[model samples]
Target: MIVVIDTSSLLSLVRYYLPFDKKGVLFEVIKSKVSSGEIILLDAVYEESKFVGQKIILQKLDFLTDKGFLKENKVITKTDELIPLAPTRFLNMVKNQFVANPFQLKKLNESEFEVQKNRFMESADAKLIMYCQHLIKDNPEEEIYLVTEETPSANDLKLFKKIPAICGILGIPVITLPQLLEKYPEVDLGFS
Candidate 1:
């Protein structure tokens, strides 16, 4: 199983678990899985988390990278294979599910649409989706899942695209950090 984690989920894991165990038992389990190539930590998510400037988050991510537990998404350059664009159907879904919502676009002028679109394009969610698509394309036989803290919003007023929703549109399976932990119940934290 190749589980691609997003930034929010990573932060949630760090904030919730690190205080309980300074050695980061849960993180260590995740790290070990990543080292074995069962897990994937996208470079975009890493960069986004580092941008948070939280010492603990930075330290944990640093430890994972330093120990070769985290695998960065393959870099796509112009000379390399051209990066695939998000499917038109997925873009349409984003338009209908997110952008077209009156509440989400409320008080925004026509000119702001471009700004909003640009913001989404540059967002970590967008980057994560791209990486997920790449992984799916490169590894068809592998079961790929996206790990994100984001839940699909019942409220149509959300200004930004949530990770799970985007994953759904892309036909990618999505799970939360807790759900992921449930899969590895045998991992003994030895919590004193």
Candidate 2:
């Protein structure tokens, strides 16, 4: 259960919005995984937390790092520039739809698509995916989990599924933060 967490799950847990528990179940799950030697976090994901300014999330990341639970994989390098190329065929279709008529306007300006693309380009998702892909390339059967809450865009769910699809091909597990809580309720999940 080498779990790779994204910021959304962490934020939700800290805000106590995703789950009804005030015990900070999300934090506990992350910590529990680390304590059990099963969690791995990308360094870029850690860096993303600084933008959040949430003391609790930062503390939890630090705590996990101190315990050697989080791994600094796919660290963002200075030379690594953001390459925001749209999906070849996907982009063409979107463009064609936009050019065709005004009826598809709502679908064109989808927030979900923008969020995912932004996340892929500048956030932890890209780093985590690259790291996981490398891990799979080397050790095909290694188990990894991607912790995130960003639902796939209605139009791009299939593209979003590529994350899990890659994981599935590589025999990894991708679960949301809420799912982790459901599975590991006994773990100490609190942020004080």
Q: Which candidate has the top score in TM-score?
A: 1
> Which 10-residue window of candidate 1 scores lowest in summed lDDT?
73-82
Candidate 1 lDDT for residue 128? 68
What stretches of model 2 exceed 4 Å from their correct place? Answer: 17-29, 35-37, 53-56, 59-122, 154-173, 188-192
C-alpha lDDT score of every prediction, in listed order: 0.66, 0.54
Which lDDT value does model 1 have at 121? Answer: 59
**After aligning candidate 2 to the native by TM-score, how far in Å is the CA of 121 from where it should be?**
5.0
Q: After superposition, how far is residue 62 of candidate 1 from its true place, in Å?
A: 3.7
| Candidate 1, pairs of clashing residues | none
TM-score of each: 0.74, 0.53
Model 1 misplacement above 4 A:
22-25, 64-90, 154-158, 190-192
Model 2 TM-score on a 0 to 1 scale: 0.53
Task: Give, for candidate 2, the lowest lDDT window spanning 10 residues.
Answer: 70-79
Model 1 error, position 186 (Å): 4.8
